[model samples]
Structure formats: structure tokens, C-alpha cells
Target: MPPATLSRTEQSYLLDGLRSKPAERADRRDLHEYRMMQVDTDLSLQADGSARVVLGSTEVHCGVKAEIESYDAPHVNVSTDLEFAPWLPPSPRVQVMVEYSPALLHEHNATELAMITDTVQDMLQACYALTGNSIGPLDARQFIVVPYARYWVLHLDVYVMSWSGGNVLDAVFAAAFCAMYQARIPGTKILALDKAAARQDDEVDQDDPAGIKFITRGRKPSSSAALDDAVDFALENEWDHGRLLAGREDVPVCISIYPFEDTYLLDPTLEEETALSSSIAVLASARGHIYGIRQRGSGELTLDAIHKAADVGASYAKQLAQTLQARFV
Candidate 1:
């Protein structure tokens, strides 16, 4: 006689067993522990800055290239693209392309594709908002070489190289942070404004060869001792751009929590994700301030669950920020 196959209900029961008393997962990791992650910075010599991140089986790459443009307002342009390996089995893919111009929005039709695009755009915007309206090290105000005349335009490109399981948002954010941490901008010096020339006339001298300067975004030190230490560190390690950027206390990180029955799982794998009833993605700073919260899935979360998830997410974000500082700085 042929062996009997388990029904859908039976299969679900078995999977639930992995999450019940005396729970056992293939990786043997605790429910709260995230998967192994590896972050490599400055991977591209051609780009201004670049990083590659591997979280569990997922891999993401980010590159930043900057140019000086004549504009009244400074802006940071972000774009994302995704490509799957041909050998892999067919699966759903999300692609987001953001342009600075408003004309690109009309190209999207009112279909599933449009929804995916909109979702991706919202996520990116949340990331930017969490980091103080800037995706890279320097904000628009700092990028301006000449007020209302010349400023730096940064183009951040992110690509999903591989996807196996786990949260892609965490991986993408990590890669982006690393890339920005390694970025350096050209040195600029102000010149006297020419009263007779047009306002659009170039006010910055591009031929200066004094050398590039590393851009830093953070609050000034509160004490003289801290300021002295920072200056000493900078003078001793002038070549270390990544360290300076990574040391910023205001840098934010993301945490994703999924609700599984009565329990909540952190950095859930593909199997756990499929079994999840609802999920929340939290973007928090190192100091545990919740900057962004996004919910998904068919099930609803109670008020208590939302608060618990936020607390858990904040703790995880703090830990992640510390780890990145230790590794990169």
C-alpha cells in the first residue's frame, strides 16, 4: 500500500508544533534572535560609496553617486531596482523606481503593479523621514556649496541581488547605511558673490584640488572633553570616513516583528512569515525613538500587541545600532 499524505490541516499542525512547547526550528535560534548578518562597506571603487549586506540567505547591494547641480532647492533622489536569477523558480517580485519629476507618477496604472510600486515608495519615504529627511550622510542644507545656486545631488541606487527568506527591509536599510557611512564629498570653499552675474551663474570653483572632505551629520558634542576627543580622533585617523559616519548616535535602524498566534517573532524566516497572521515593521533610532510603524497581513493586532511590538522593536533597534557601531567604527 502507498503511504498516506498529510492534509493541509495536518501540515499546519506540524508547522505549529515548531512554535509550540519545546519548540524546535531548523536553525535552532531563539524566537527573538535575528539571523546572521554580514556587512561589507566600500565594495565599489567606481562609485562614491557602496556596500553589500548578507542577512541569512538574502543579499542586498547599495551604491551612492553624487553630482553638483544648479538648483534652488537641494534634494536627495532615491531609486530602487530588483532582479532575480533566471535559474531560480518563478516568484513574485516588487520593483520600485522613483524619479524627482512628477511626470513619472502617471505611468503607473491602477493595478497590482501600481500598488506594489506605491508600497515601496512609502517604505523608502519612511526610511528617509526617520533619518531626518536625508538618505545619506549629509542633508540638503549641508550639501549646498552656494546657497540657492549650487548644491550636491545624490543618487542612491539599491538592488536586491538575492532573496531566500527573512526581512528584506532590514537588509536594504543596513546596506544603505553602510554605503552612506563610507561616502565622502568634495571639499568646497565659498567665494564672493558677483552682483552683476545671473543668479544661476556658477559660484563654486570646481578646479580646487585641496582634496575631498568627509561629510558628517550629527549634533555637536555637549562637552569640551567630547569635542576634544572627536578632534583628536579625526586628526589621528583622517582616512577613516566610515568610522566617523557610523559613530553618529542619531542613525536609525529597522526591526520587523511578525505575530504568530499568541506569540511574536522577530526577524522571522520565510516559513514563519507564511504562518504569520499579522506583522509590523518598526523604524527606530539608537535612542529607542519610534520613527515609523507599518502594519501588514490579514489579521488584526490588538492595542496591547502593538505596544508590545514597539517595545520589542525598540530594544532590537538599540542592539542592532550598537552592533553596527562596533563592527564598522
Candidate 2:
């Protein structure tokens, strides 16, 4: 990119503006308030939860929705709108729907999008486990024996409304935290899974002096055959009728950084983003379990820098988790 022409006074003013903005602090250091700029919330209607987050002009919108599906792939568990369109290919026995829409993927550069999706999935799965059984209110054994294939699905959609270039992944993570915090899952009671289908009428009524029922279920798809069967089942029924469900809890927090020069920028401006040589994002659970780390793109980040980034990510993650948790109160 060619440099823009400016008079000496204009150049001085620009330099002064840049100087007034604090230099990037070391990863382990606390993030200064001035450097962070601003934080905003509330954006989305249809989702169970939603938030529009802004960090120094960089913008990302996040929404959380829940549904029932029989199966899901492990790594791509975030289940954002980005992957909804691709049509799955038809094998000799099955068809895989796959579609390509640049509009969805265009928001973030290609590599960044991949990182964000994976990070969110890991976090949400952790929360899902606390909700109880993987398949539904019933255990896998019950579901397999009876097999009412309806699965509850949670879709967390992230939209990049604006990008000034800084670390979009970090911003994406923050927005996701806010959205998930605002989300809630309805109380659902498990019915008989062995019957192939369960009805709302079969729900154990707590008020009727009858009784209460609840059960447990995330298995990621490993093979095309497995995915096919799951998809076939998901498309075939609707099973969340009478299940005791819990509100959302334990959201995973992510911190992302793009490394440039010897200095590491927390969120790079568009110009810095273009200048970056490499990027790494670290996702941590509230317990400090390092669930995922994605290191890719063209940059050369040193081993030391990588560790430092994790520390930075972990700190910010804790702060994010605390802030979001407060929202629930």
C-alpha cells in the first residue's frame, strides 16, 4: 500500500494523535482503559441472547440460539450461521448439504473466521455438558434403545459489523461471551426415547401430583457415515417437546492476538492487520483449562510470544467471564 501524501503540519498532527494513543502494553500487563476505547452491548432479537461489542472501533455482533439435532461435528461445534448453507454431497447412501456464501464468511478474513468458530464451539460444549445428558433428557443408552432422534441445537451467530483491523478474534470472543451470558435454555423434561418419538402430552407434570422427569447428552461426528445418519435423524423429527432444561451457564472465554514486528498488538487496526505476519488465539475455560489454541497464517510468532499471548488471553478471559457473569445478576 502506498503512503498517503500529507503536509508537514498534517504529518505532525497525525503523529501526535498516534502518540496520544498509548503504545501496546506487554501481554502480561493490565490492559489500560484508554487503550481499550469503549465497550457496548445489546444487538439481536431472535436469538436467546445477543450483544454487539465494540473495542476501539472494531465491532462484532454475537447471538445465541438453541435447537435440537441428533448429531454434530466435534471441532465445528460452534454451529454459527456461517456453515448453514453449504450443501452436503450425496454419497452412494446419503447426501451432505453444503453451500458457500461470501457474505457470511466475508466479515472476517478467512483464517480468522475458522479460529472464532472453533473457539466458540469448545466453550459452549463445556456449558452444554453441565445441562445434563448429551442426546436429550435421556442418556445415550436410552436414546439408542428407543431412538426419538430429536436433538436440541444451540446456534451462536457472530456478525462483524465493522473492522478497524485490530484483533477481530478477541472482539468476536468478547461478543460471544456477552451473548451467551444473556442466553437461557427452557426447562425441558425427558420422555421415553425408546419409542422413536416423544410427545409434549407425555411430559411428567410437576403440578399434577403425578411426578417430574429429567435426563441427560455432545457427540461430535467422526465419519461421513456417522454424520449422515445423524443428519437424517435430525431432519426426520422434532423431539424437544417435554424436557426439563436448564438456563445457560459456564461460557468459555477467548482472547486473540495478531503478532506484528517485535511488538504484539492486542487488536490491530486495519493497517496493522494488513501489516501482521502471523496470529494466534487462545481459548480458556473459567477454570483456566487451555481448551484450544489456533496458531496459523503467514506470521512468525516466537515460542516466548506464544506463551505470553496465552497469559494475556487468560487474563482478559477472566475479566470477560467476571464481567459477563455480573450481567446475569
Candidate 3:
């Protein structure tokens, strides 16, 4: 049988709604309201950290694993892989591998794949910057037991279970943030390295749970009090099943804005996404600073539209950040 296609009437209706104001959309959400979101963290025992995020009908799962590796620098390594369900349509399946040296560099095949990789890379960099380049509260030195020798390396993997359209970047960023929030690196104590002996001897302690110090950012009591209350409510209702993540105060959330004629809509649906003339994504810190911005889709964006979209995205980012913070708390 031939593949099914949208009927002309259906297509026309969707296009008309996309061009209309947000209130006219079938969901009746305001121009600034986002679709419903559900987030769960620490769902995988085998991984150092893991999270599953569902935004409207789109679902994504992210897992983070870490290990100690000999390195010359003190930077976190990030790798991202995006996989669609086997039943989904045929599109590019790509993986982005990045190693942070003196500069950031990535390896991928195909121009299209390269673009995807660059987009994801930019998002990850923004996330790291939003956290002040610290894993939790500890500085880069803390991540290294032996400077210029051995340090921690983190691997992040993300899988898309469903694509209902809209901005997948928002979902990806949320999942990555949740996974990183829940990630824990095992603690270690380094012994002195002996080089004068006939045989060099280096010893390190690696198997003591009591010595295991969790990577965490110190929480600010002023803002954390509200988060704590929210957490209590979530726990009571069983909405959050994972342990509270450390250093959550610095995490950020992203929001994507789709532009119709003169209106910028927040969290467009699949139909709206298809009809969008242009789009922009913004990554905002928990404190409301714009950390990163990217233009998306094939449409051109005016300078005014960019400014407007950033402002709108900031609002949504704040809301989403608070919501995710409460979940992680």
C-alpha cells in the first residue's frame, strides 16, 4: 500500500491555524504557554545518571556514564547520540562526539549530519557555561585527583522514542540537563607516585563507598526553600521517584520559538512547526540570562523578531527551569 498523505482539506486547516494567533490553535494555549511536560531522573541503575523527558507527545531518554581517564586538560568531554524508533520514518541517524581540549572540536560524516552535530554541540556548550563550568559546585581541579594526569570523563547518550513535531531541541536540552543533574562521580584518593625505585609504583583508592564524595553544588537557602517545598509535594504525590540531584541551583532550561507572520509562538505543535516561516531557540540560565541562541528552519528572521523571540523564550525558560528544578529537588 502507498504511504498515507495529509488530505488537502486537513493541510489547509493546519496551515490556517498556524498563521492564526496562538489562541486559535486547537490546544487553545496562549502564545507563551508551553505544552505539558513530564520529567523523571535517575531511572537507570547501570548509568551514573539518567532521565526521561516527555514534552507533549515527544519523548526522549538521556543517560550519563563516567570514568577516570588520563588527560592533559581539565574539561568535561561530551558525546551525544540521537536515535529514532525503528518504526519511524527514514531520516538521518547521527552521533556527535566532542572532546574538549584547548578548543572544542567534533567529528561527524555528511554535511547534514555535521549541521546537526554543530547544533547539539552549541547546546551542550551553553549548558556547561550556564553551570559556570563547574560540575556541580566543584571546580575543574576537583575533578582531577592528579593534575595533568588523571581526570573524570563523562559520556552522555540521548535516544528519541517519539517525535510529535515541534522543537526537539527543547526536549533534548531538558533531558541532558536532568541526566547531568543526577550524575554522580565516584570519589578517589591518590597516593604519591614513586619514580626513583627500580619499578615505579602508583596507588589510588577506588573502592570505598564511605570515601565517595558526591559532586554537588552548594544550594542557596533563599531559593532552595521553595524548591524544597515543591519537592516535598512531589514526593508525597509520588510524582518524583529519583533522589534529589546535587548542584541543581545552576541548571538551565531551553525554549524554542516559532515565528508566524509577525507573531512568535512558544512550543509550537507539529502542525504549527510545519507551517512556521522561521524559528529560533534560546537557552536561558536559571537566573534568566540568555546563554545561547540559534536560528532554525529555512525562514529568515528580522532583527526585531530575534529580539522578541529571545524575550519570549526567556520567560518560558524561567518557567521550565523552575519546574525542572522542583522535579530534581
Return the top candidate by lDDT: 3
Kindly give the stretch of ten consecutive residues in candidate 3 with the minimal lDDT sum.
84-93
RMSD of 3: 15.5
Across residues 1-329, which tens digit of lDDT does each residue of candidate 3 receive?
00123576876786676566444777887776777778888789788778988888767778877655553322232232211111111211112233212111232224534465466665665454313334432233334444234455567677655545445678877887777776666554444332311022233233321112211211122321121211100111221343233455555677888876766677777666756556788888566777778887778888998998888888878877777777755
lDDT per residue (tens digit) for residues 252-286 in model 2: 56666665444455554444444444667777655
Candidate lDDT (C-alpha), each: 0.55, 0.46, 0.56
What are the TM-scores, per candidate, against the unseen true structure?
0.66, 0.54, 0.65
Task: Compute the lDDT for candidate 3.
Answer: 0.56
**lDDT-best of 1 and 2:** 1
Give per-residue lDDT, candidate 2, residue 267: 52
- List candidate 2 segments past 4 Å from native: 1-42, 70-148, 190-249, 258-263
For model 3, the stretches where C-alpha displacement exceeds 4 angstroms are 1-11, 18-22, 72-118, 129-138, 193-248
